[model samples]
Target chain A: MCRTGPSPDPPEGGETTSTDAAFTALLEDSADELYESAPCGYLSTLMDGTIAKINTTLLTWLGRSREEVVGRMRFTDLLTVGGKIYHDTHFAPLLSMQGSVSGIALDIKKAEGGRLPVLLSSVTKNDSTGRPQLIRTTVFDASDRRAYERELLRERQVAEAARTQAEEDRERLQEALAVLQQSLLPAALPPVPGMEAASHYHTASPDRLGGDFYDLFPLDGKRWAFFLGDVCGKGPQAAAVTSLTRYTLRAAALHDPDPVAALTTLNTVLHERYAAGDPRYCTAIFGVLEQAGDTVKVELASGGHPPALVMRQDGSAEYLPTPGGLLVGILPSAPFTATTTELAAGDTLLLYTDGLTEARIGEERELFGDVALRDFAADLTHTAPHEVIEAMTGLLNSFGDGLDDDTALLALGVPTDRPDTGSDSPT
Target chain B: MDIVSRNNVTVTGPQDAPVLLLAHGFGCDQNMWRLVAPALAENYRVIQFDYVGSGRSDLSAWDATRYATLDGYAQDVVEICEALDLREVSFVGHSVSSMVGVLAAAATPDRITSLIMIGPSPCYVDSPGYRGGFSAEDIDELLESLDSNYLGWSATMAPVIMGNPDRPELGEELTNSFCATDPAIARVFARATFLSDSRDDLKTVNVPTLVLECSQDVIAPREVGAYVHDVIPGSRLVTLDATGHCPQLSAPEATLAALTEFIGNQS
Candidate 1:
C-alpha cells in the first residue's frame, strides 16, 4: 500500500495540493512574523493624530504595552514638547497639503523620562470617499545617525568658535597697532597766535600701520617748532623709528631752538640707533614760525624732503626751494639746506611729504606731480587754513583708490581778517 | 544691494488692487503660500517675498548684526513695502511671521491696513504669572533638534556650503521640503524668533486685526491667541476648526473665507 515503483507519478495533483497547503500556511506565518518584528516601527493614527493601531515593534521601542498607547494616547503625546510643537506647526500642515511627508527627523519621548531619536516617514490614507481617514507612519531608529550628526555639529561649532577667536585676536592686534600709531602723531596741532594752523595725516593702507608723523609744538622766545616727516617702509620697525624721531626733535628743539639743529639731532639719533646693518632713514622738513608784527617769519630746513609751497595773497604759488639736502640717517655728517619764508597777510605756507605728489591718477596710473600741486594751491590763494585742508582732502577723496601712499600736510596761514576771539588752544 | 533683489521680492496679482502681503514663517519661505496666495490673487494684489538668507534671497546681504533680532526682519518687511511703493496693505502672516507682521505694523501703521495673524505667540519663554507656553530648557532642546536636523541636511546640500552661486537650481529643486533654510541663518533665526518678548508691542497695533486661532495648536495655543486678541484694541478673534498651527496650508478654504469676509467688510 505504500507506493511501489514510482506509483504513477504519486498522484500528481494530490501530492501537489498537500505541499501547497503546507507552504501557504508557512508563508502566512512568515508574513505575520515579518511585520511584527520588522527593523522599523510602524503606527497608524487617526486624522486628528489619535493613535488607532500600532505594531509590536513600535510598542517595544517605546517600552509601552499595546493597551497603554492604543485608544489612550495620541501620536503627538509620544513626542517631546518641542517635537510636538514642530509636528503641529510644520509636519501636519505639510502632510495634509501634499498627502504625505517623509524623512522628518523628530525625537520621541520614551515611556520613561528620556528621548529616542527617530527619523519618521508618514502618509495619510484616505477612505473610499477620499476623506483622509488615518495617518500611517513608519519610524526608524536614528540614534546612530543622530550621534554622528551631533559629532559633526560639535566639530563645526568648535571650528566656528576657533575661527571667531582668531578673528578677534587679529582685531585686537590691529587695535594695538592703531593705538601705537596714534601715539606717534600729535593729538591736536598747537595753536600759533595770530596764525591759523591745520594739519592732516592720511594713512595709505589699513592692514599695516604707516610711519608718517607730524607735530607743531611751541618753543621758547615766542617761537614754534613744526615738523613733517616720513620714515622708511611701514609697520612696527618704522613705527619705532618714527617715535624716536618725534621725541628727539622735541628735545633738540628745546635745547637749541634752531630748525637745522633739530633736524641734525633727529638724524644723529636714527643713525646711532640703527647703524649696525639695518639702517633706518627718513625724509623730513623742520621749521619754526614766529610772529613778526602782522606777518609770520618761517625758518625752513629740508633733509631730503620735498619743497614747500608758498601760496601768496595774489593767487600765485611758488616752491620755497630748499635743495642740496641729504637723506637723514645715511652718512654720519649729512649735509642739509635751510630756506626762510614769510607768511604775509592772506599767505599760506604749506609743507607736505612726497606722498601727495607721488599719488597715482587716471587709468594710465600717472603720478600726481608737483606741477599739479602748485596749480591746486594757486587756486586756493585766499582760502583759510581749514578751508585749504578741506579742499585738499576733497582732492584726495576724488583720487578714490588711486592714492596709495601716506600723505602728511601742514599749513600755516596768516589770517586775512583778525584772529577769532577764542583762546589760543586748538579745538 | 538692491533691497528688492536682496529679499527676493516677487510681486503678482492685480497691479491697481490693494496689497495683500503674505509673509512666510520661520521654517519655510514664500513658497508656503503657493496654494492660498493664488486664490487671494483674484481680488487683492498679492505680494510675497523670501526673507534674506532664505529661499532665493541674496545671501551676501545677510549681516549678523542687522539680522540679530526680530526688529531686523520687521525692518525688511517695511523696506519691501517701501520698495514696491505699497501705501496700504492687508498683511497675512503665519507662525513666526505673524509676530513679525505685528512689529512691522506697529512701526509703520500707515502702510498696513489690516493684520491677519494665523498663529502668533507674543513671547515664547514662560515667566512668573505668565503663560508663554515653553520653558527655557524646552527652547534649548528645540535648538538642539534644529542643530541635528541641519547637520543631516548639510550632507546633501554640499553645493550651497561650497558657496557655488552658479548652481542656484540646486536650491530651487528642494523647494517642496519644509526645512530648506541655510543652517547658520536658521540657527540665528530660531534664537531670534523663539526668544523674543513682544508683549509690549501688542497694545501698539493700531490697525484692524484678525486673530485666526486653530484647535490643538501646540506652537501657538488658544490662550496665546486670546491674549493677543485681548491686548490688541478692536481685534476680532475667530477659532478655526483646523487642528494645527498652519491653517493656511491645512485649511486654506476656511482661511480664505475669513480673510475675504474681513477684507471685503473693511472696504
Candidate 2:
C-alpha cells in the first residue's frame, strides 16, 4: 500500500521524486501478487499444450501443488478422459486454426479423484516474428453452471424415458389388438368336397386392427356358406362390430343358409344393435356353394358390396352384377339382392372388399378402378382358387403404401376332376 | 428418386476415358478430393458426389431406414454409376467409404473395374481376433466428443452453415472451419460408420484393388490397413510418406501420385 498520497493535498506536492519512487515501488511489488490472487485461475502453456506457468488459485482449485502441474503436465492432462479426447481432436485444432477459443465447458480432474467443472477461454500468443509461442488461458469455476446442465440432462432423460415407455406401451397395444383381430377371423377354411377355396385378409396398418373378415363354414346337407365383409372404419370399435357381424352371419346361416335371407338377418341384427347415436354399417357378400347334378351352383347375395368376378377357363372375366343392394344396417330394410351362378369344372368365382378397387394408382388420386381389376382378373382365368388368391394378394402388395384400407378376399373354384369313389363310396 | 441430385453428382474430364469415381469419408464431402481430383480429371473422366445428408446434397433424401447401414451408401454409388452409365470405373474411396466401395463392387461387379481405398479400415472397434485400433469405450468417448463438438460449433455457425443454399463454397468454408453437417444426421452417420464391421466384405471384392495407407495415421492405423490388404485378394498396398487421416488435404501430391499410379496400372 502506497500511503504517499493519503494526505488531503499531498503535503509534499513539490517533492516529486519521492512520490514517483513510491509509486514505482508499489507497481513492482503488486504485479505478481495481483496475478496470484486473481478471482479466476490463470495459466500459460507451450504451443503443444504443456503447462509453463500457473497461479496459486488454479493450483488450489485442482488441489495440486505448483511442482506437479507446471512443466510436468499438459493442460489437457488436467481434463477427464473424454474431455481430453475432445481437447485433442477439436479444441487444439480449433485453437491452431482460429488462434483462440472461448467459453469451452469441460470437467477438470482434481488431484483426489474429484472433478471441477470449468469454462476455459484461451488465446494464442506469438513472438515478434509472428511464430506461435505460448497460450494464455483463463479458467472460470463452472460448478453452478455444471449443476444446471446436469439438472437439464436429468430432466431430458426423464422425459426420454417416459417417451420410450409410451412407445413400448403403444407397441404392446398394437400386438394385443393384432392377436385379438386374428382370433376373430376363421383359422382355416373348411374343405369342401370337389372344390378348392382360398381367402386372404390384408390390413392396411399393422398397428391398428382392421374390420375386414371372412369365413367358410358348412351348412346342413350338401351346402357350404361363406361370407366376406368389411365394417366401416377400423380399430377396437370396428373390431367389435366385425365380431358381432361374423357370429350373427354364422348363426343366421345355420337357420336359413339362403344368401338373401342370411344377409337380411345380419342387416336386422346390426341395425338393432347400433340404432342409437352412432350407426354401424358394413358392406358384405354372402354366398352358398351347393352340389346339384354334375356342376356346383353358387348363390351370392350382396349388400352394397362389389359384384363378384367369375373367370372362366377360356380366359374371360365378367362381373356377376347384384344390383340395387344397400349397405347393411343403414336402413332397417336395406335391400339384399341374391344372384345364382354355376361353377363348372373350370369356373372360379372371386369376391373382394373395396380396398382393392379403391387403392390409389402411384402418386395420383385416381383409384385402381374396374378397368384395372378387369385386366387383372382377365389374366387369371386358368388360375386355381389358391393361385388366384396368391396372385391377387401380390397385386395388392404391388400398390406399395398406396392401399390405405383393409381388404378381404375369397375365391371358390370347382375341381377339374371329381375323385373316383370306389371302396369308400357313400353315394 | 433423382439419384443424380440426391448424391450431388458432378461429372467432368474426358467423357470417353475410364471413369474415376471419388467417394469421401466421414466428416467430409466430395470437396475432400478438391486438390487430388483436378489432376486425375486431366487424364480420366472424374466423377465426384456427396453422400446424402452431406455437403450440397439433398438432406431431404436422408431416410433413416435407407441409410441405416453401409449398404445404403453402396447403393448410392451403384445408382450413381447406373445413372451416368459409366462402365469400367476406378472407384476411389477414403476412410469409411473404402468398405462402401467394396460393397458397391460386389453389388455391380461389371460397372466398377478397380478399387482404391485411402486410409481404409474394415472395422474401427476391436473384435475378438481383430486389432481395430479402438475399443468400445473409446468409441463411446468419440461419440461424446462428437456431441460436445457439434454443440460447440452449431451454436455459432449454424446460420452460415445452413443459409447458403445456392453457393456451395459456403458449405466448403463451413467444413474448413468446423467439419460441418447436420448434427443429428452426423450423429447417425458417425455411429453407422464407426460401429460397422466389414472385414468379411474384403474377401468378396473380386476386382483389382489398391490400399493407400498413410504413415502415422491415427484414425486408420497401419495394422488395420494391412488387414484390409491381406483380406482383399491380390490387392496392392502402398504406404504413403504423408501423415494424418486426410492425405488429400494435407499431402495432396503424395495422395495423387499413389492414385495416378494405381489407375494407370489398372488401365
- Candidate 1 has a DockQ of 0.32
Top DockQ hit: 1
Candidate 1 residue pairs in clash (backbone atoms < 3 Å): none
lDDT of 2 by residue, B173-194 (tens): 5433444566567767777788
RMSD of each: 7.7, 11.1
Interface RMSD of each: 2.4, 4.6
Clash count of each predicted structure: 0, 0
Compute DockQ for each candidate against the true complex: 0.32, 0.11
C-alpha lDDT of all candidate models, in order? 0.82, 0.82
Note the chain A TM-score of all models in turn: 0.84, 0.72
| Per-residue lDDT of B231 in model 2 | 91
Clashing pairs in 2: none
For model 2, residues A179-295, the per-residue Cα lDDT tens digits are 899877888888998789999989787888898888999997699999998899898889999999999999999998888999999999999999986899999999998998778
Residue ranges of candidate 2 with Cα displaced over 4 Å: A1-161, A171-249, A256-427, B12-18, B34-44, B53-72, B102-116, B126-131, B149-188, B195-216, B222-244, B251-267
